[model samples]
Target: MTAPAEPPRFVVMGPSGAGKSVVGAALAERLAERFPGLRFVDADDLHPASNVEKMRAGIALDDHDRMPWLALVGGELAAGADGRVVACSALKRSYRDAIRAACPDAVFVELVVPAGELGDRVVRRPGHFMPASLVASQLGALEPLDGDERGIRIENTGPVDGVVTRVIAALDAGW
Candidate 1:
């Protein structure tokens, strides 16, 4: 993990079924527990209406639809909330780039889960606009972390507590 010059923004990113939300939430809680002043933002809350509609109807979003969403999420990153963890399905490198453009200091934590497990997760989750079928497209768009970046790329194959603990350790190590 590369230590940031500052308490850089972080996006807990991956495909739809990669436990981004679950792990992001856990990480946020952990951060809050350790540093009461820390703030955590849920990036999904910034998605545009049309993009939500598209995903709700099982239609995959193109880069065009995602650009504005990226910008919005990035805007939040620019706020520079210390120990913040934003949950976003940052499926492409360009999408990651867009968010980074807004807050160049931020680092990414690539949450990873096997395809088969992801399918199971999508099936089990409820009330979310994202459809299980859309997982394939999201996976298709993913750019692997290449194990080269200075952040956690967790297996996301464990329980939420364990996952969160790993992230906390990674962050402590300044990933």
Candidate 2:
């Protein structure tokens, strides 16, 4: 019989409103049966209050504002190296590099959706500090997963369960 695949260290990454939280949660639930210690961390929880306030005020955060938050998220991922599913914006290549520095084997799952969809999703999301007005800025900062990156880009135009299934299949295939 084939050996079971190793539990994945997944970072559900994308610009705002790409369904990172929903998909990551679903992925974690699906993987929990096999990976007992798996946990999900919402990177937004690591953001400083000031950053949250800024975003709530419709101000886009700069790289400097994000470094500390990224470091914290990286630390969590590294600490949970055995099995973790984290939802994070991870917009810039440099930010992703920071995450990789902490957990070298991390597999990023980048969620891609059209701008209009992204905007609508962001606007409809309740209680999120990130305002729809900043969607463009987040998109502008986004750096797609590169050839050398250990990652996959999934279009999130459909149901959350469908996206989660694709992620699981990709992980099983060692993508």
For model 1, how big is the CA root-mean-square deviation?
2.2
Weakest ten-residue segment in model 1 by summed lDDT: 1-10
**Model 1 C-alpha lDDT per residue in residues 1-175, reported as the tens digit of each score:** 3544555577889998888888887777767665555567777789888888988898998989999989988888777546567888877778888988887766788887889888889889887788889988988888876555545687897689998888778777765
Q: Write the per-residue lDDT of candidate 2 for residues 56-150, one digit (tens) a residue.
A: 99999998898888888888887853578999999889999998888877889999999889999998999888999999999989999998998
Error of 1 at 164 (Å): 1.4
Model 2 accuracy (lDDT, Cα): 0.87
- Minimal lDDT window, size 10, model 2: 1-10
Off by over 4 Å in 2: 1-7
- What lDDT is obtained when candidate 1 is compared to the true structure? 0.79
